[model samples]
Target: SLGLEKMPFFTDSTMAKVMLLLINTWLGAPYFMVLISGALTNIDGAMYEAAEIDGASRWQQFKEITLPILLLQTSPVLILTFAFNFNNFSAVYLLTGGGPINSEYRYAGSTDILITWVYKLTKEQSQYNIASVISIILFIFIASISSWNFIKSKSFKEDSE
Candidate 1:
């Protein structure tokens, strides 16, 4: 082993939250970057030209042409990512194990999101009934979000004429 000591990332409450945030961001950012860049490239150059001909300013062009297209193109992935990260067990579990315990919350740590807290309830605390109820509620909530996203998403709407 190298002489350099390993920093205790999980020892402090705020630091653990920061570390978890950093980890999740670092792990997930590149995929979104690649997808967004791909979406950017797919935008037609003629749209900007048309907007320019219509006397629209660059900001107007972006607002009118770019933002809507990008939002439509990436809305599905964005929604899915939100749902996935809502219960991202691995990111918090593998990195900090939901550590830096807080005295305020019983059976939960500072970085413990709801999913990890449920996990702790079931696995560590042996409180199966509460964990089951929580899991059911979480499933219903996530399902509702996903259903709403699909229903309201312009990208997913089928045109029937």
Candidate 2:
């Protein structure tokens, strides 16, 4: 006995994206918090005191000191997190199953990411060649992003200097 009640947040594609993002953030926030907490431990309280003595506002101190130090300390973790999320096959597969299918698309559903699309190509359709190509492209994309992030990290720069 189905009712005509509206639940757009669950049914709508746009809302589904928001829901997935919220879920992802909820899942990832703990790890991010831990990394940031460790970085915060490394920052000297004297630095904040000195900044306050110089008449720096809270926002200014955060922007000039805390943000940079956190970013520097957590850059590697950030990069790894990016890579992990980029290819998060299990989350996509188990939670949504690349669902809310769009009839227009050949194999991919509305929520189907690259990994899921590749899975469909390989498993359902048995198109190994195309799946391999897609996998290669995905690998290249992830690798390039990771490489750029690594190069831009403070540790890399510090080592070079």
Candidate 3:
């Protein structure tokens, strides 16, 4: 609610996109924070003590020791977060409902992600066949990404070895 009455109209797709991202991040941060805090607790204190003995500065300790352990331990959660965001429909649907339509794109609004677009096609337009096709495509895309993430996860690799 900036003084829009005083300022010139600045309607842009980028502003809506940025706002959506910020809102989604705000909604998602708490979950990731919990995961990261658990991972942090599990990190070995001996590692930090060794780093301190080696005259490492606080930044150096964080960079060389803390960051790597957190990343390695939480990589799976990161992948899960990516997957969740990829298919996230409720946030976009509830907040914007795929609004501020772009005239150029057929049946698609500027803020519509793939899932919301599919929902619109099915519910509003009665395009069941097209919606089904789009649903299959979305499923394939998510599955591929999830499989790739599992393959790349440290736990999966460790189990294989």
Specify the highest-TM-score model's number. 1
Over the stretch 41-130, how does candidate 2's per-residue lDDT look in tens digits?
A: 999999999999999999999999999988888888889988988788887777677777778777987777898999999999998999
lDDT of 3 by residue, 90-141 (tens): 8878877777678986677888888898989988999889889988988898
With candidate 2 superimposed using the best TM-score fit, by how many Å does residue 148's alpha carbon deviate from the native?
A: 1.3
Alpha-carbon runs more than 4 Å astray in model 1: 1-8, 159-161
User: How much is the lDDT of residue 7 in candidate 1?
Assistant: 75
Count of clashes in candidate 1: 0
lDDT of 1 by residue, 30-107 (tens): 999999999999999998998899899999998989999999999999899989988999888887778888889878
User: Against the hidden reference, what TM-scores do the models get?
Assistant: 0.90, 0.87, 0.82
**Model 1 misses residue 124 by how many Å?**
1.0
Residue 29 CA displacement from its true place in model 2, Å: 1.3
TM-score of 1: 0.90
Candidate 2 at residue 49, lDDT?
A: 100
Sorted on TM-score, best first, the list reads: 1, 2, 3
Whole-model Cα lDDT per candidate?
Answer: 0.90, 0.85, 0.81
